[model samples]
Target: MIGRLNHVAIAVPDLDAAIATYRDTLGGEVSAIEPQAEHGVNTVFVTLPNTKIELLGALGENSPIAKFLERNPEGGIHHLCYEVEDILAARDRLLAAGARVLGSGEPRLGAHGKPVLFLHPKDFLGTLVELEQA
Candidate 1:
C-alpha cells in the first residue's frame, strides 16, 4: 500500500529561520515558499537526491500547526509522508486494520498538490503518518 518515502515534514515556529537553516546553513536547494491555505500552512520544500524535507509554518491562528507549536514551543517533526498508489484503497485497508484516520478519512490536497490523508499518531508508533497519492 505504501510506496517510497515522500517527504518528512517538520513544524517550525519561525518559517524564515527554518528556511535559512536549510538553505544557507545546510546548503540545500530550497523551493519557494508556497502557501497551502486549505491545509493552513505555508510550506517550503528542501529537495534532496533521495527525498525531500518539508518545512511547515502555521498560516493562521487556527492552524493545526499553531496548536502543535503550542504543545511544542520549539517545534519538531510533524509527520512522515509516504506515497501510495491508490489513496482510497489505502484508506480502506487502514480502516479495516483498525487504524484511525484523521479528519474525514478522505484525501485532501497537500502542499505538494497531491491527495493526502493523515493517520492517527498513536497507531504508528507515536509518529503521525501521512499517505500521499503517488
Candidate 2:
C-alpha cells in the first residue's frame, strides 16, 4: 500500500529557470542538478519540511520529458510519487485490482536511488502516479 507522499514531479522546459524560481524567487533550498541518464532526465530537488519537489528536464531528444514538453510547452506537474513499504507487493495488489502499470511493470531506480514504478495515468484519474520504495 502507499505510504507518505514522496514528492511531486514537475516537467520543465528550462531546468535553470525552474531551479531559480524555486530557489531565488520562492526562497527554497534547491539541491544540485543531477543527471539521470537512465531515466532520460536531469533532476533538481527542492527540499521542504514535509516533502520535496522534483524538477525534471529532458536529457535528450527522445526523453519522455521532451515529449511531455512538446505536448505542454509550458510544462506542468508530471507525476505524484507515493512511498510504499514493499513495491513488488504493491504492484501485485494494483494488478489484481485491474490497475495498469507502465513500462515493463518492474521497479526502476528513481532520483532518490529507490526502486520506483509508474502507474497508468488513466488508472489514477488522469494523473500519473509513481510508487517508490520507502
Candidate 3:
C-alpha cells in the first residue's frame, strides 16, 4: 500500500538554525518557512536528490511538536512519510489490519498541499508514519 518514501520529518527546536544547517552548512536547497497553522507547525523543506527533508518547529505552545521537543529537548525525527496511490484505500486496509489512525481518521492538507494522514506511532514499531496521497 505504500510507495516511495515521501520525506522524513524532523522536529527542531529552532527553525531558523535548522534551515541554516541544511542550507548553508549542508548546501541543501531549502524552501521558505511555511506556517501550517492547522498542523501546528512551521515547516521548511530541504530538497534532496532522492527525497526531501522536512524541518518542523512548533507553531504554538499546544502544538504536538512542542511536546515532542519537551521530550527530546534537542529535537529529533518526528515521523516518516510514505506515498500511497490511494490514501483512503490505504487507510481502509490499515484499519482492517488493526492499525490506528491519528486524529479524525481523515486526511488533512499537508505542507505540500496534498492529502495526508498520520498513523499511530505505537502501531508502527514506535515510529510515527504518515501516508500521503500520490
- Estimate TM-scores for all models: 0.95, 0.96, 0.94
Report the C-alpha displacement of residue 2, candidate 3, in angstroms: 0.5
Which candidate has the highest TM-score of all? Answer: 2
Model 2 bad stretches (over 4 Å): none
lDDT tens per residue, model 3, 7-124: 9999999999999899999999999999988878999999898999999999976887887898988889999999999999999999999999999998988878999999999999
lDDT of 2 by residue, 1-134 (tens): 67899999999999999999999999999999999988899999999999999999999768978878989898899999999999999999999999999999989898788999999999999999999999
Query: What number of clashing residue pairs does each candidate have, in the order they appear?
Result: 0, 0, 0
For each candidate, what is the lDDT?
A: 0.92, 0.93, 0.93
The worst-scoring run of ten residues by lDDT in candidate 3 lies at 60-69
lDDT-wise, the better of 1 and 3 is 3
The residue pairs in collision within model 2 are none
Query: Which pairs clash inside model 1?
Result: none
* RMSD to true structure for each model, in Å: 1.0, 0.9, 1.1
